[model samples]
Target chain A: MALTRNESAPLFSSDTANTLRLIAYLALAIALMVIDHRNGWLVQVRYFASAAVEPMYRLAALPSRLARSAGDAMSDRARLNTRNAELERELLLAQARLNRLQSVRDQNERLQQLLEAQRSLDLGVQLARIIDVDTDPFRHRVTIDAGARQGVAVGEAVLDAHGVMGQIVEVLPNTSTVMLITDPAHALPVKSERTGLRAIARGNGALDSLELQNVPISADIKPGDMLVTSGLGGHFPAGFPVGTIGSIRNDASGMFAVATVTPSAALDRSGEVLILHNLPDPVGPPAPAPAEGPPAESAPANKAPNP
Target chain B: MNRLRANDWLFWGSIAACYLLQLMPLPQAMLPLKPWWLALVLMYWTLEAPDYVSLGRAFVLGLVGDVFSGDLLGEQALRLCVFCFILLRFRARLRFFPMWQQALAVLALLLNDRIVLLAIRAADGQLVPAASYWLAPFVGMLAWPWVFLLLDDARARLRVRDA
Candidate 1:
């Protein structure tokens, strides 16, 4: 190769040039963050980046998947038989429970037909494996193996066997990120199962509790009452279990109550979750409370059936 | 030609292996002790073969790391560029340090990385992370000598011609 060594090359190679490059890169990064957070200019880029990194996630999950398969393979015949028997028994019990639910559903449909209420939510559960978890203190999230390819969409509710887990905030081609209900930025509309008292449950960035905001002190909600998605404004399907009200406190100002709810799902160990990809068609927002009846704050949920 | 390629493999291969290690998912309980694998590997190359891995390379690798780890845009990019800048400027001194002292220097760099991470998170309005978040750097520091020796041994055994 013939080298054309020019005097101009020295300027590009000098120490000052390197410093200039550093400053330029840092400036570029800062510009990216400012533009990204403000207008989400890089959201699509991030999504594509996530798709590009899907292989890394698969690589990361490979060992654990192998271990689990190996453990299952190594179990002795007797142990396998015992596990099968246990599962069969559980299935039988579940079927018996379903029989009762079948009758209740028929009753509900008949009543709904008479009342002309919007049809009930057809709860469809799709299984997904949690491939990666974000331990960032401020953003609690998990990446699932399901994505747009699996019909998972943003704003779809995710649940484990126990109860509501969170909702899909972002979807890539082959994977999706679920922002856990415990994340500070996440909020869900919920109602007291017993009193029909409505409130919005917002994550406090804590693992164990969600906070209820703007709940009036006069509201009849109490600790130990169950909260279910009311389907108001509709990010989640109606009647899904959200949490148990753990504690409630009247604020110092005396007008409103602050309540803490213990999440029903095991947020820490959700190995598998079911994504509710479709909201049972939401009935429009419920009739606002009468002026004379207590004022219950309802935040318009941006997506789904308010069943 | 084959010998130089082997040497390149020796350098890039170790970095790739470190990435694999970094990407592996650890149980929640063991997450805190996960070493800074990419940083350690990058440090090894920047000190031993400074001409091969440049600041642009580091910046790009950090962007990949950020996206793979699902961190905010440019968080890792900025952190890694700073890391490379410091390493390049002080390459002569850092290269001559005894193995033990080298580990200490790595500890310092990793600690700086942690501080930068905290500053970024705070600026993004995130709550302070747990004490456990600070443990990985120490773990990486302790693992440095072993990693350095292991890569050295592997390269020597392969008899890769130097670039």
Candidate 2:
């Protein structure tokens, strides 16, 4: 009845073959990590792995989603009536705002044509619900229900009602991974709504604040200045609310100021997001190229000299 | 024949259950406390049933772990393979340790695993993780006695003699 290994001679030992195998596996692992980081040739492998693991996430999310639907079903009539009234009032307000926006949109289109700019059609978006959040402490990311199958491409801007959320970093078959604006690896092209002082906001691995580096202390930026996507780098569309400046700390060297900004979006919460499927203009006419923000680069611009 | 097959199915079934548990979401505050369920389970099998859980098997499962956790492909494979190697080397002594001592052994193993994780993360240019990231191994240590007891009870109740 004893279920132990019954070999008369112990089969477990520090054998040469095991050591060789260990060395081989370690080499393979390091090679894989290096290759995946630099070349990305193993993207197909990641896609396959993501497809395999997505079902597990779905299974895990099923319980909470079911409970939510159950709660929705069990809500009483009085609550429903109050909610309906609230929604109707909200709808009326939105419709009224839309009526005014219609005229502004038409006038903007006419102005865009006068500037001889490429089609400045409105940005389009698709809705997708977040399914799971990344558990790694170093990275801030989420998995959404939409992917390449839904024509959701990588680098597409994802958003919530509050502000620019992040971008689609990975596109799997049925689910895509989104890197949040708070991830240490992400940076956004933003400009001051007041003075158009362009700056790059890089996430510092802290959810509450992002650091705007290398802006000279004399730069025309201040606390409470709303930052909208300047559309300079063209990663995100123009005019999306990004964040508000929190504090400006003068560096010890006094060469530049580092300002921390709290993101406008409630990034820590899980909910539906709008994926900007089409950006309004892919390119702009050449000029002083002031219309061009920073070129799209993986890293934030280290320096932008003011003339 | 059918009765013998049930035991094999049960072993794989428990593995699948553990995999699912590893996938389960914990609240953000509790993230650092979530034990490495897969590593613990792998350790359990390597300790109790060395025949089925070989170094190669450990490597493959580690690869699966890398994929499941969305890490680089070989990261878990390397970690698991090294852990399995050590477990295999020490299985003769570990198989006979009392439950309390077994828990100590698990604590030691998990602490070592954390060092490996640190090394891997450092290679990836990540800064030192939050203090709580180191707490997971101790969490696994606390869960070990219960996990061992539960699995042993299931193994006994099933009345499946070892091959």
Candidate 3:
């Protein structure tokens, strides 16, 4: 048998053709980027495409999944027993803490009833396991095994056991993409747990740091002050832990203060998360009290109905 | 001819492996250091068997890469297109270079890809990446020789010769 020689031809037939193809492909790519960045026009396209590719992601995740299970199975009995004991003790401690908070919650509810204020609604929460973390260095996103079919909607708040993790940004049929609070584009309205001074916490493209925007230098907030969602935007429920202020300094213009905050959530490591549902719409400025007898000022008297 | 029947299968299989390597979950600290495995593999095929790699293929693969990596839709597509176009232009010289020189050339190519990424990010109004962001190309450069040799061996075994 005659040996066949390897023949590796050039990819393009000619220089002109190469240049033309490159220009065309580049133009298409730029157009896609612009369309994707400008709006949600490509969201459906992405959803369908991701649905088709979901199996590939699962296959890629298989090794890690197997390893995790194998590690779980191979753990020594003594270590498991010790871990069980540790968890039991932690549960007991949490129960004790809950007992104290339970009375305070009851008193607060009673106070609300007496005042005739809108009853605080309890949002539903669902647990989702993080299936994959984005490999792109610039993006801090993860794919959770919950999606539209599971009634996971965009904009739902996600949290780990410790604090707010992020919000759902896109939902495919079987999986959803969650944008971490540490993403550069994300911002959360938060208030100082110590002083109640409201501020916006903006992600600075780092997993460990969030910058509080437009903070006042004279504000009572300081290092170590805990921040919690203010529920002003209605995206996140009120009082969820966000982060702790790390350092504060005046900006370049000295017009406003900037405080760097270390996020409280495990932005890099959480394997499981809780997604909050049934968040109420932004309850626009509270209706003026009827007792004040200012009937003319309360133009929009009808309260927005809660779903 | 009978042996070459599996050529297409092997080619796609290699591409699949590269994608898996790229999408495999990595620790946060190691993410920036993850080399562009798909690029390296594509470069090898383009140099050794350009019949299997083309500009269109590169663009399509990059688009899929973007989806898998969760980047802006066309970001990786553009990056891979530029990468492939450059590789095609210099294939004659690059194919004949000694292993070390070829590795350096690959480094330059990966560095160019990084610059393209930087421009894309800048256009998207993202902040400048950290210094560690530039580290992946060096890692890719170091891995180039081994990748080339490995794929070369695989190609020879698969008998991907001209008809």
Best model per lDDT: 3
Q: For all the predictions, what are the DockQ values?
A: 0.37, 0.46, 0.52
Q: What would the TM-score be for candidate 1 when compared with the true structure?
A: 0.80
Candidate 3 per-residue C-alpha lDDT over A8-69 given as tens digits, one digit per residue, 9 for 90 to 100: 24433235228889999999999999999998577777787876568877887788788878
**Candidate 3 deviant stretches above 4 angstroms:** A1-17, A71-82, A97-122, A280-307, B160-163
Q: After superposition, how far is residue A143 of candidate 2 from its true place, in Å?
A: 0.6
Candidate 1 residue A282 Cα shift, in angstroms, is 8.4
Query: Would you estimate the TM-scores of all the predictions?
Result: 0.80, 0.83, 0.86
Better structure of 1 and 2 per TM-score = 2
Docking class of 1: acceptable
Model 3: per-residue Cα lDDT at residue A147: 86
Query: Stretches of candidate 2 above 4 Å error?
Result: A1-17, A49-51, A67-92, A102-118, A133-135, A250-255, A278-307, B1-4, B160-163
lDDT of model 3, residue A167: 94
Decide which is better by DockQ, 1 or 3.
3
Model 1 vs truth, CA RMSD: 6.5
Native-to-model Cα distance after best TM-score fit, residue A272 in candidate 3, in Å: 1.7
lDDT of 2 at A92: 83
Question: How far out, in Å, is residue A187 in model 1?
Answer: 3.0
Cα displacement (angstroms), candidate 2, residue B108, comes to: 2.9
Ranking by DockQ: 3, 2, 1
